[model samples]
Target: MSRRRPTVSTSPSWTVGDLTVHRVDEIPLPPATGAWLLPAATPDVVTGHDWLHPHFADAQGVLRLDSHSFAFVLDGLRVVVDTGIGNGKERANPAWHDLDTDYLGRLTSAGFPPDSVDLVILTHLHADHVGWNTRHENGRWVPTFPRARYVTSRTEREFWAGYAMDEARAQMFRDSVLPVEEAGLLDLVDTPADGATILPGLRLLPTPGHTPGHVAVELTSRGETAVITGDCVHHPVQFAAPAVGACVDIDPVRSEASRRALLGTLADTDTLVLGTHFAPPTAGRVVRHEGAYRLAPVPPVAPVAPAPVAP
Candidate 1:
């Protein structure tokens, strides 16, 4: 499960028409072997895919899922979709418990300082996604982006408000989620009937089921479209086998349906995709590979432009 990462640009930027998007990474997780994370993502299947190699999966067929975030800069607004796992926390999972990283520094490297963020969206308040919503401060947790309005669906916040089934979930809610609520910066928004338009070009599309109210952030400008997949579909292996649900998915059945629908809408189109947990060169387009689908990673040198997706 060792991840031998190659040297690559940490902040890989994308231009979706006028809006600029940057990938800010937190941690490069060690590879998960043979459905350790997804039941159908076995070594044989991963090795056979061919397309996942050297990017999603290694030469030996180990899968690496990163905890990362996307910063979208449009007009005068700087919004971050899904903050990566933050430092200093207690968790049932040892890898994520009591740790530290240069996530904030990388955000600054991506031209987004903590204070510069106007809005921070929690796609769903999972440990990895919402960890950076707050930070440890003087024996307490505080909103990391103090000036930003931390946004989440009312359904999501309300569901997690009472989610104390396990110690880790309780601690995560305590340290990462509630502080934003206490700060008076937590904007519990209702998912719009049409779509939640944060600004003119950016939208939040409700693609629930990974969590009760998970959302995928969409960016559209000057006739181009891009989507930030927030756990709707995590690893690219799911692209070829949509039925393979993640262990962390709250409702595998619902998550599978959501994944299929999301892929159906995105397949063989110009819409650029940025996976929340996809490995290096994370941005790409969904294309029909044989009969199934695949996340053809956008080449680091130059992306292959596909046909314009219908708006």
Candidate 2:
């Protein structure tokens, strides 16, 4: 008898008018810390293991999922949202150290040239979120997207600039962020007190808590809408247990409150939700399931799947 392998499902992509959306996949971390940001009541339930593993044995035994980075295309503009962990980053966790990304190839595979990106919108200045902001060239960190403008929240910029100096996080600023600023491509956006439209169909909505200056990007066009959530909510588990906050969260209480409110606002809307760290097919619709919210992945059908054969 031979063992059968689980079918691998590829991430989905879609176009909103002229904007082509790409979901870039990355490696996942096993749950080694018994307590997850959102833990399940029972160990066997898939919910608990979906986001993070509680033990190394469980992590090795279970099939780990991929994290995602999103790219938004609009009017001859290729806007990348949240650069995943980059190469050569010094962190306490070895897993996140010195990541070498083939994101340029990934972008080309998605049909957009590397230099074609017009804007790079970072939801925050977290290490994982800005890793790809630069690439190593001539033994130095330089802008990855040479021609693109990098936009980030002013509050986030100031916070990290100050926090990075005394904290271990300072290396991220010196390596990834400062270079972008020095290149004159960094744009500091004012944290909108009330939601404000940044582009024709794009709006910036305040959803502070994961970080002091964190904001969610809302896109709308011809009755279609989607919200690109950064770390405002890390995993699907938070939908049911909104109070659960990741250990890295700056303000757990505020993060909890913000999660509940954002979930509620989209609970009844047709907005397509995009999560930065969400598993493959990161783009989805939020639905009420089993008395709580759940993400229903948007199925990719145009690219046909292999037909099954009888044994």
Candidate 3:
């Protein structure tokens, strides 16, 4: 059976008091190459194999380009949640090498200026999550958002700072991470395991296992809340098989536990979930159906057209 490409849509400007949420569109991964690796030691979550067909062909698979970075506008602060794969980096994976992302323009177009971004929250220290941390300058790595203070978990920072020197992961730290540290912009945050309020409406929650110190950001205002799941639950398949863990997960068993607990909490709540790699319309709510969990895609908001003048 052939699979249809997912359609894209944008939600109306959602406001939580003074904070506004906007989704930036990035390139989409080709179908045939998107579904390469299954969770290392876990059962296939997106069963039927139909859902996996598009991303693979003749043993070759592709990860979809639905990769995204989110922007949150709060009280006098433009906070960029995560920076997508950036340009001019030496990546071990050829697919991510020397990539150019129009993230700056996407931010500006969405009403937040790149330079105006006051804080950058890195959910983890992975290559894709921290790619835009810096830019090349004078043959050196420099802070990409000159005015923003880059934030990461203390454990995550320490782990990568040492692990980055290793052959396989060193390039990740060199071109994508260390540059921000060298620029005095990196802020190591020590957040509680359950969750903690970062700002008035923004909170941080530890959902580790994918990485030891990984976290998910939650924004709430006047009862309206949304969570940036980061990489805790990468693909929609996990919604059905919460036990399945990504191959790269540092602790698959622990990660599965975290995913299950987190999903359970939001299962019946009003929280809108924002996943970094969940195709398009990256924002949605978790609903219980057929005695199993499912991801219900949020409908896109219709664009407001200009008013008609006297004809």
Residue 160, candidate 2: how far off, in angstroms? 2.1
lDDT of 3 at 50: 40
**Colliding residue pairs in candidate 1:** none
Candidate 1 structure quality by residue, lDDT tens digits, 154-267:
888887766655877888888888788888998877886466887788788887778888888889999999999999988898899889888878888989998898899899
**Candidate 3, superposed: residue stretches over 4 Å from native:** 1-18, 30-34, 40-65, 302-311
lDDT of 3 at 45: 32
lDDT, residue 160, candidate 3: 64
lDDT of 2 at 76: 45
Off by over 4 Å in 1: 1-10, 192-194, 300-311
Tens-digit lDDT track for model 2 on 1-311? 98564332233565554444667665565454224444432345443434333211244333223445777666446677888777777765576787666666665555445577778888888887888888888989999889889988888778766663644577778788899999999998886677766678777777888888888887776778888898897765566557667787888788888888898888856778887766555666777765667676664434322112223
Error of 1 at 286 (Å): 0.6
Best by TM-score: 1
- Residue 46 displacement in candidate 2 (angstroms): 5.6
Error of 2 at 142 (Å): 0.3
lDDT of 1: 0.81
> Positional deviation of 186 in candidate 3, in angstroms?
0.9
